[model samples]
Target: MSLRIGQLPDRTPVKLSVSVEPDLACALADYAAIYAETYGAQEKPETLVPVMLEMFLSSDAGFKRARKALHARASKGDT
Candidate 1:
């Protein structure tokens, strides 16, 4: 089922933090930076986070395609 804006449940914001490996952190930063560069005019952090979340959550098709490509590359290397 598709989500409707009016059908969303009420929610409260909570603060959460997690640690990532240095390389992974760098990757995330790089992704955010590129997003800011392309879409961000002034490159505000406030705008960047929400947009990043939206992109991540909405990217099921992209993620599936990426996973398939990665598996193909790995299998090719194993042969």
Candidate 2:
């Protein structure tokens, strides 16, 4: 019973600490404000940062290719 979709990945949450330049911090705050206005829901910049990063990583074709290659190598027991 092969399925097109693979098994779901782990959903455990990990906490990360990051530092940004003042200007970038301001930009994140502005983005959060715009997002709140667009969606009618308020979210802190900190809350949005990880989601934005995940979306960015998911959208990168090169990253996807490299990740796939790494997974294939790991599956093959290649160091």
Candidate 3:
């Protein structure tokens, strides 16, 4: 029997810990404030970090090429 709905992708969340310098911490807070002002929605710097990282990674050409090569190697079962 075929169903219209497909199996959902993994939604498990992973927690990460990072340390930043005081200046960078202050900058992140300022960025969060500007983000809230620009979008009229309040978001914590922690909440924005993953999204900002994803955006940066998606926009990086070298990372994209390297990621593609890595995926190809993985698919070929290369170490």
Candidate 4:
């Protein structure tokens, strides 16, 4: 399912805060563990969250098209 989830870009880190249920937290932790094992580098769940989110967003074709349309409108001073 995540075959297209490529490596995250190397960039300056930013901090963020979010709240999730215990089960979701555990699931993120599990994903972090698998990500570490898969890539041979351990990462905290905090780090995985953004990378996973970016991967999810980038993989959505409809979202990408809509985002491009929004950008085009914004560039043209349209909302």
Candidate 5:
């Protein structure tokens, strides 16, 4: 018997707004800057956020674990 794996369909573009603590935001920016500097790239940190998010979301285990944790937290009314 042969096994087949299905691919995810393309998603529509959506706009999301999120607010982060000032320190967290600064830390993320600093990390991004370091990454860019290490790679000798000129892209701004803001441009890296979506790419990082997509990379994380694209990993099967990472996505599943994140979703499970998020659901569990939501069920606990932690959000």
Candidate 6:
């Protein structure tokens, strides 16, 4: 999808704010540095979080099944 996981084929914009503890914040900073080193581009780790999550969720079979079922029901006018 992206250079790593689900790298967003498009740059559709969404703004969100999240709260995390100091340790997690430090970890994310570390991750950002690593990601920059790996990808040869310096970008905030937070920028990758949503794509990472989407990729992770995409890889989850249970989520896929549930989403598929929900879609099917929606198409059939059954909530």
Residue 50 CA displacement from its true place in model 2, Å:
1.6
Write candidate 1's Cα lDDT for 1-79 as tens digits. 6665566576776555667688866777777688668877555444455667768867888777887899998989952
Q: Please give the RMSD to the true structure for each candidate, in Å.
A: 10.4, 3.0, 1.6, 9.3, 7.0, 7.8
Per-candidate clashes, comma-separated: 0, 0, 0, 0, 0, 1
- At residue 72, give the lDDT of candidate 1: 94
Q: Compare candidates 1 and 3 on TM-score and give the better one.
A: 3
Tens-digit lDDT track of model 3 for 1-79: 8899998999899999999999999999999999999999999999999999999999999999999999999999995
Give candidate 3 misplaced runs (Cα > 4 Å): 3-6
Give TM-scores for every candidate, taking all chains together and pairing residue i with residue i.
0.42, 0.80, 0.86, 0.71, 0.50, 0.70
| Best-performing candidate as measured by TM-score | 3
- Of the two candidates 2 and 6, the one with more favorable lDDT, higher being better, is 2
TM-score of 5: 0.50
Q: What is the lDDT of residue 6 in candidate 4?
A: 90
Residue 41 of model 6, lDDT score: 93
Candidate 6 Cα deviation (angstroms), residue 65: 0.7
CA lDDT, every model vs. true structure = 0.70, 0.97, 0.97, 0.90, 0.81, 0.88
The true-versus-predicted C-alpha distance at residue 4 of model 2, in Å, is 12
In angstroms, give how far residue 11 of model 2 lies from its true place: 1.6
Query: What digit string (tens of lDDT, one per residue) describes model 5 on residues 22-45?
Result: 997898889878987899876665
Candidate 2 lDDT by residue in tens digits, 1-79: 9999999999999888889999999999999999999999999999999999999999999999999999999999995
Taking all chains together, the TM-score of candidate 4 against the true structure is 0.71
